[model samples]
Target: MKKTALLATAAALILSSMPLSASAAETAAYKLSIDNRTISFPDAQPYKLGSDVMLPLRQTAQALGLKVEYLPASKEAALYGPAGTAIVKSGSNQARLADGSPIEFGADAAVKSNRMFVPLSFFERALGLRTAVQEDTATAAIFTPEQTEAVVRAIVERLVAGEYQQLSDLYFDDTMKQSVPVEALKAGWEQTTATSGELTGTQVNQATSETPDQQQFVVQLSFAKAKAILSLNLNADNQVSGLWLKPIAEQAETPASLIEEEVIVGEGTKYPLPGTLTLPKGASGPLPAVVLVHGSGPNDRDETVGLAKPFRDLAWGLAEQGIAVLRYDKRTYVHGQSLTPDMLASFTVKDETIDDAVAAAKLLKADSRIDASKVYVVGHSLGGMLAPRIDADGGDFAGLAILAGSPRTLWEIIADQNAALIAAMDDGDPAKAANEALVAAEFEKALALAGLTDEEAKAQTVFGIPAYYFKEMDSRGADQIAAKLTKPVLVLQGEADVQVYADKDYVQWQEALKNNDKASFKLYPGLNHFFAKSADGKVEAQVVQDIADWINRP
Candidate 1:
């Protein structure tokens, strides 16, 4: 299976049975380009089947339109455009685009999903994307419109809210009238602690005056238990003018020091996975190990996107409490190689995510300091759905803790995903027609294959299954295997997580585990998918910050 790790095998065998000569195998290769520079793929002889040629996906898809990103570890990606965002990936390619329906690029490529797969030339021509033949290099210019008063306010709010590290990437060089580096904000981050505003407000009025070319808005901020205000300056375009320095009223939670020792876990391994294993300061014997699996989006070890570092905070806090914690660098962030969108369609559950989880679980089990029998898995969001199957894999694990998991097929989940995301947006209009049409088409595809139904026209699903419902179905026998789940399960639900709401999904879980008694479910009254407390499930709830509400350290 290791050498067979090539991606195309699952559906590829169904594609071309023709045995091409070795020379033709060499000719039908792919190359990746970034701003006319080569990133991953190159002019090599004999391209292996099913390899992903990851240049920036955006540069390959038509510009500023809906784009897709892949996170191999999580086994997912994000698709966003004027419509909304859909999570795309190798197995579950459900994210749909605007007028950009899934279509084939030619015999050389096809879109078995919303993800577009193209020959090397498509990348070169589509987005001015190109790779250098002379050297292994990547080059791309990020374009941004000038920041407005609205944009700057939003940026400072995020900075004040601990959602972003820097605003530089958000805007273009031409639009950056002025700005401040992170160093200048150290003092600001130190102040504002213990202030009532530190818990409820972002009004950091530290700097009242503006430099000759700037205006400042200091926002109160908190992270890692430290609280402070962010001083943002305004430029002529109403963009960020510059960064300001302000003395601190108090510094509540400063890192012990920035000089942290970088420990490389897999010392001699190439492409060694990145992660941190935190063991309690004092443990008498081998302790229970918990692997913190991330949610849907491309995330870092911290799971820091938007205001969701709950995973990182949990890892550190729990490890301190005697439970060992393990979290890894998501494939998307690992940065060097990315699975191209083209290769994603043929994906299945085992091909993308399960293997990585399996590898990590085994890696931790082998450690002398860990109790293999007590190895546990705690998955949040999409990882939650994946946990049961992981348990079904016959691994050495204590149990599963699902933070907002689902029991329905990912295909049905996509329909719900579309409804939820669109409802949360300002547009407020349901793209129901588009969603329905896609469902119908998928069911027809299935009916044609199974020959089990003649009512294809009115069929959105068959036998309780929706079209494309199993678009990424691997483990077709999971429900059959559930009869064997003797371990305990903790289902943590957030009443406000409409995207994967407990009422719909948790009920499905309840039914599937029907007569089983080893299960427990807890619904956090006001939490959302991010596990952040909220009144109703809405995108805005994620933006409102609360320190360590959904997670508690060991």
Candidate 2:
């Protein structure tokens, strides 16, 4: 059949493909950009098929925000985009998108390096996504979801295996190769492996500046003894220009005066959250209790990020001072993502934050070891903003403690954080432009949400969350809610926290609650958002002591 002959021809060309030489391929890298931001690919390099650029299939779909499912039985792959679906068969140049849109490609889909390869033109024609390839710098400012995973996997495997020479040859640029000698890299890997144990798994914590020309991937590699972050910053030439490891800070020695317990929060709920309860070791009577709440994101009870665990530090440090403390994993942290589309559509802060916190407080109040009359809530960042809402929902807390709390709208806070992060980046840094583009996109999404009806918002997603969630949050003003609460309030602000500006957020809190005599505020001069000691790079002991004193005060 003529079809069989076409397939054979495509196969013959691919089988004869040769590896690109370093000298010839030095500037042969390709860049992919979607919505004007660069997307970086680490493992699968782009190659040309005549005049068209080709990419690994799965990665390309992911970059385009499409979900892919391969049917081994049929030798077919289905890509589901937000708007439609596309189907491609192996060894065929024919494909179809949703609505029966036909695609005739010059090259047939084939398997290579254990991945499916397809032309970028398929996405451009079928999904209406924009893509470009820059052969000059071997850059593509385009991103697909799969490329990120592949890159992270490749880097983590190489680092853990202690393949320093290969890494230098494959990933490092001229400056990086000169700076990180192979012996030094090998010794570093040996020390890290010996300390952390054999590599078990890796998770991509974050990806930023995903333009086709450059990218930064932060990965959390779990080892037997501990976890460490391997951050890779790649340049236009697809070389590792910057590389570093960030390990979790060791917890300060637990004082003899304190004890920590693992417990469950909201036990009867659909998802019973796990938590840590810290109390004085030898308490003979009921002790005052404070329940710690995390800021935004899927945070553990410790609110672990990078090398910091602010909540854990707070829990043990306060318990050492004779105060009982409780901190639980966020709902979204455990059950938020597993929910069905319908469930997520209706998700809001009420379920994500307020409910579990109220449950924790009720549990604490009922505990024989806790003084029900003195139960308080300590909310940091997003938690702090919702403290009043928690109380209004019958937390019946004795008081509220606000740390790095923002009185501004949640979206405003997010925008400010994005702006600050972008400002901190250096000029001409490719990441800066990409991040700025992301910020612009987020703002556009937020603006679109402002006009949607509540019902419509429920059916949509913004910044990767259900738009209804934002609608519900924007409907309630934490500052207004806090102003009406009669409970004693303690507000703590870090003057140096650019994430939540002290001059803006702290000042707004003081002004809003000035009429409420039960409210008080404390401002630390040099502390950052996490209350870490800027000089020593750990959560300051004094900050913990201050919270304990504020709670213990008559």
Question: Which structure among the candidates has the greatest lDDT?
Answer: 2
Q: Model 2, residue 1: displacement in angstroms?
A: 37
In every candidate, how many clashes are there? 19, 29
Task: After the best TM-score superposition of candidate 2, give how far the Cα of residue 105 lies from its true spot, in angstroms.
Answer: 25
Question: Which lDDT value does model 1 have at 114?
Answer: 31
Each prediction's Cα lDDT score? 0.47, 0.72
Superposed Cα deviation of residue 446, candidate 1 (Å): 8.0
**lDDT of prediction 1:** 0.47
Q: Which stretches of candidate 2 lie over 4 Å from their true place?
A: 1-151, 154-226, 229-253, 425-441, 444-451
User: lDDT per residue, candidate 1, 1-554, as tens digits?
Assistant: 01000111111111112122221122234444323233342222113233323222333442333345454465444444333333333322233233434322112432322332333322222222211221233222222122223455577555456543344445313223111223223223333222224444444452433222234466654444434345565542344534432223221241232111233334454435677776666566887777777665445666653333666566655565566777786554463233432333333455444555666788788889888887888877767777877776744567877777777656556556544433443443243344345445544554353443323312434322332224435234344444457767767777877668777887767776676687666776777776665321122233212112222222
Please identify model 1 stretches exceeding 4 Å from their true place: 1-271, 335-337, 421-470, 474-480, 534-554
Task: Kindly give the stretch of ten consecutive residues in candidate 2 with the minimal lDDT sum.
Answer: 1-10
lDDT of 2 at 378: 94
